[model samples]
Target chain A: MDIRKQFGANVRKHRQATGLSQEQFALQHDIDRTYVSGIERGKRNPTIVIVNKFAKALDVSIADLFDGCD
Target chain B: MDIRKQFGANVRKHRQATGLSQEQFALQHDIDRTYVSGIERGKRNPTIVIVNKFAKALDVSIADLFDGCD
Candidate 1:
């Protein structure tokens, strides 16, 4: 019910929809695989830097990433 | 020159333009002041959840936040 949980869930959905594994995503973004896992699990609070990397690597707009989370 | 630094600079610019301290902005968004500070300094990578909170707290579109960062 929390916003962060919703956001994380959305991220997981998108990542899976794109057919990219967490390791693949992290490698594309030059981040640790565990970091990507942590983010999907809501164990990490990524900064804007990480978000930008994700936006670029995932080929999604930041708006798209945050959409419907509200 | 990195996207993250640019994003952080934009964030700081917007925050200062609105005359908000990190604590005030974090309070408004129910985030930790230190977390907000970390974001401004490009030391943290906020998740989409945090970005949404920031977009709402700052009254700006997520697109606007990423607009010139690229």
Candidate 2:
């Protein structure tokens, strides 16, 4: 189901929904901005803990990231 | 939120719910039983893609892995 793309799109959606830039998202999460870019592009494979971090930084839930992917 | 523990516990729950042993679960997902053990113990970190794989193999949604872990 291209979960990477689905997850990435959901992450991007959450970021945008919160009105945060990639840089802001990265900063808030203490992750590198480039990594955030990679995640959004579905180029980076992040771990479950990392996904949880993204969810936290975006003020969303791990479940939320799988809105359509699931 | 101790996401690792939360996430790992959820994985164990899903695996148990499906009545699959560690080896069986590992075989279905093509992941190593030891690695699966690590993940289930919250000792290993998995990527989003791997998480998706687990969800698929468990016949559950990614969100289900995060039921009480918002």
Candidate 3:
């Protein structure tokens, strides 16, 4: 599968599930909104550190972001 | 937890389980041996693309590399 796109879709799913728009999620997570946008669109390739940050921000396991990706 | 360190350890564990040296693994994956070395040492910040490459090379899920990281 296309892991990046899957990851983006997963992130979007979780983020929306939390009732947080991209701007709110980015603000709460101290991430750039544009960066979050890029990530959610699968246009950004984030380092593991950033991935960890996303996992923490989303309150999900790193694996959760990769669900359906493998 | 130090996600990078945990990821490196997981990679090492999986790599060793496959009975392949870093050099061999790098060559087989078309990655730089030095980059692999850096990753195993927790000194590199690899993007998800590279992480996916490693997972594919090691025949593990991308989440497997971050197994204990979250």
Candidate 4:
């Protein structure tokens, strides 16, 4: 399986589940909307630093990010 | 506790556990020795890209990177 694509789908699913727009999620993580978009589109692979930031912003664990992506 | 420090210690511990020097680990991950050194010193926050590479090279899961650091 393509982890990046799976990860992107997971990101999109979680973002929608939280009722947050890409821009809102980005702001919550102190990142740019484009960055979030890039990740969701599998155009960029985030670093662990950014991943941790997402975990915190989403009030989820790192493992949660992989939910449904496996 | 500082996650950066904990991560650094974890990185160092795993490297030693595998009997790999920083340079060896770097080569395994296709990263530079200085980059690994910076991470081990908590001076650099690796992106998920590098983390995944390390996970693959170490023959471990991402969760393993957190072992003994929590």
Cα miss at B22, model 4 (Å)?
Answer: 2.0
If you superpose only chain B onto the true chain B, what TM-score does each candidate give? 0.84, 0.89, 0.94, 0.82
Ranking by TM-score: 3, 2, 4, 1
Chain A TM-score for each candidate, in the given order? Answer: 0.80, 0.89, 0.94, 0.83
TM-score winner among the candidates? 3
lDDT tens digits by residue: candidate 1, B1-70:
7766666777787888789788887787788889778778877666566666776778787666676775
The reply for model 2, stretches above 4 Å from the true place, is none
Candidate 3: tens digits of C-alpha lDDT, residues B2-62: 7888999999999999999999988888899999988988989988888988998999998
- Location of the lowest summed lDDT over 10 successive residues in candidate 1 chain B: B44-53
- Every candidate's DockQ is 0.42, 0.78, 0.88, 0.34
Q: Which ten residues in a row have the lowest lDDT in candidate 2 chain A?
A: A47-56
Q: Model 4: per-residue lDDT, tens digit, A1-70?
A: 4556766777777788899999987887778999889888878777666767776777767766655433
DockQ (model 1, Cα): 0.42
Q: TM-score per candidate, in order?
A: 0.60, 0.88, 0.96, 0.78
Cα-based lDDT for every prediction? 0.72, 0.83, 0.89, 0.73
Worst 10 residues of 1 chain A by lDDT: A1-10
| Local accuracy of candidate 2 as per-residue lDDT tens digits, B42-62 | 887787778888888888888
Best by lDDT, which number?
3
Residue pairs clashing, model 1: A46-B45, A46-B46, A47-B44, A47-B45, A47-B46
Could you give the DockQ of candidate 4?
A: 0.34
Q: Across residues A1-70, which tens digit of lDDT does each residue of candidate 3 receive?
A: 5677888988899999999999999999889999999888998888999989998899999999988877
